[model samples]
Target: MTSTQEEKAEIILNLINKRKTVPKGVIYHDYNDADGSIKMQELQFLISLLEERGLIILKGASRDPILTITEEGLNFPGFEKQREIDAIAERKKEEREKLEIKNLKGSVFQVKYWWVILLLNSIISFLIAYLTKS
Candidate 1:
C-alpha cells in the first residue's frame, strides 16, 4: 500500500529519531525502493514542512543536506500519538459536518410538514363548508 503523507513523514521522523543524525544521501538511498519511501519532490516537501514545524532541521547545502531532529521533535510523542491526534481531529470535523447536515434536514422537514398541515386544514375547511351548504 502507498503510504500517506503523514505516514511518510512519521517514517522519516522515526529514522531521524533512531540515528540522531542522518546524511541526505543515506536517507534517499535507504528508501530507494522501500514501500513507504516518498518521491524526491515529496520528500523535499515533507522536509520543508517538518523544518517549519521545528520537528527537524536540515544543515548543509540543498544537494547535500544532513537531517537532525530537534530537541522538541525527539521528545515528541510516538508515531502512534501523531496518528491518533490526526484521527481525532478528522473525526471531530466529520462529526461537526454531520451535525450541520442533520440540522439542515430537520429544518427542511419542519417546513415541509408545516406546508402539508396548512394544505390539509384548507381542504378540510372547504369540504365542511360545501357539505353544510348542500
Candidate 2:
C-alpha cells in the first residue's frame, strides 16, 4: 500500500531524529524505487511541508540539502498531552454549537405556537359575539 503524506513525513522525521542531522542523499536512498529511480519531487514536497511546519530545517545547497530535525519534530509524533487538550477543546466547541442550534429551534417553535394561540383566541371571540347578538 502507498504511504499517506503524514506517514511519509513521519518516516522522514524518524530518520532525521535518529541522526539529528542527515544529508539529503540519505533520504533519497531510502525512498528510491525498486528500479533505482529517485523520487526527488515527492521527497522535496515532503521536506518543504515539514520545514513549513517548523519540524525540520533544511540547509546546504539546493543540490544536496542537509535535513535536521528540530525539537518540535522530536516531540511531534508523541505529543499526547497537547493532542488531548486540543481534542477536548474541539469537542466542547461542537457541543456548544449543538446547544445553540437546539435553543434556536425552541425559540422558533415558541413564536409559531404564540401566533397560533392568538389566531384561535380571535376566532373564538368573534363567534361568541355573533351568537350573543343573534
Candidate 3:
C-alpha cells in the first residue's frame, strides 16, 4: 500500500529521532526501493516542510550534510503513541487472518472425513441388509 505523506513525515521524524543526526543520503537509501524511490524533489519538499514547521534543521557543512530535530520534532504529533497503535493493529489483523485460515482448513478436513465415514456406514448397512436377506 502506498503510504500517505503524513506517514512519510512520521517516518522521517522516527529516523531523525533514532539517529539524532541524519544525512540526506541515508534518507534516500532508506526510503527508496525496487518498487520506487521517493523522488529527490519529494524528499526536498518534505525537508522544506519540516524546516518550515520548525521540526528539523539542516546542520553540519554543505558537503557533509546532516539533520537535527528540534524539541517539537521529538514530540511530533505524538508519533510514538500512533506508531505503537498502528503496530498493534497490524499484528492483530495478521493474527486474525491466520486464525481464519486455520479454521477454514479445519472445516475442510472435517468435511472430507465426514464424507468418508458416511460412505463407509452406508456400505456397511447395505451389506448387512443383503446378508440378512440371503
Candidate 4:
C-alpha cells in the first residue's frame, strides 16, 4: 500500500535511529524499482526536510550522501504520540478482556445454579397463585 509523507518520514527516521548513521544510497535503493528507476527527488526532499528540522545530519557527496540521526530525532514527537496511542489501545484491549471475563463468570454462575433458579421460580409462582386465589 502507498504511505503518506508523514509515514515515509517516520520510516526514514526509524531506519536512521536504528543504524545511527545510514547511507543515502541504501534508502534510495529501497525506493527504487527493479527497472533501475528511483524516486530520488522524493527521497532528497524528505532528507532536506529532516535536515532543515535538525532531526538528522546529511553529509558526504551528493551522489553517496550519509544520514545520521540526532538526539532530538530519537525522541521525535510523532513517535512519542504514536507510543501514547498504542498504550491507550492496549489498555482498552485489557479492559475489554476483563469485562468479557467478568461477563463469562456471571454467565457461568447462572448456568451452574440453573436448578435453584427454577425451584425459586416455581415457589414464587405457587405463592402468587395462592395469594391471588385468596
Structural similarity to truth (TM-score) of each candidate: 0.53, 0.55, 0.49, 0.50
Q: What C-alpha lDDT does candidate 3 achieve relative to the native structure? A: 0.78
Could you say which candidate leads in TM-score? 2
| Number of the top lDDT candidate | 1
Give the Cα lDDT of each candidate.
Answer: 0.81, 0.80, 0.78, 0.80
Clash pairs of candidate 4? none
Rank order (by TM-score, best first)? 2, 1, 4, 3
Candidate 3 clashing pairs?
none
lDDT, candidate 3, 2-73, per-residue tens? 356666766766777788888977876766742246887777777777778789989887654698889978
- Candidate 2, run of 10 with poorest lDDT: 30-39
Model 4: residues with Cα > 4 Å off, grouped in runs: 1-3, 31-38, 79-134
The sequence of per-residue lDDT tens digits that candidate 4 reaches over residues 1-134 is: 12466667777777678789889988676545322444778778888888887899988887878999999898787745767988999999999999999999999999999999999999999999999999
Candidate 1, run of 10 with poorest lDDT: 29-38
Q: List the residue pairs that clash in candidate 2.
A: none
User: What digit string (tens of lDDT, one per residue) describes model 2 on residues 1-134?
Assistant: 13466667677778778889999888778655322444778778888988998999988998899999888888885334556878999999999999999999999998879978899999999999999999
Model 4 root-mean-square deviation: 10.9
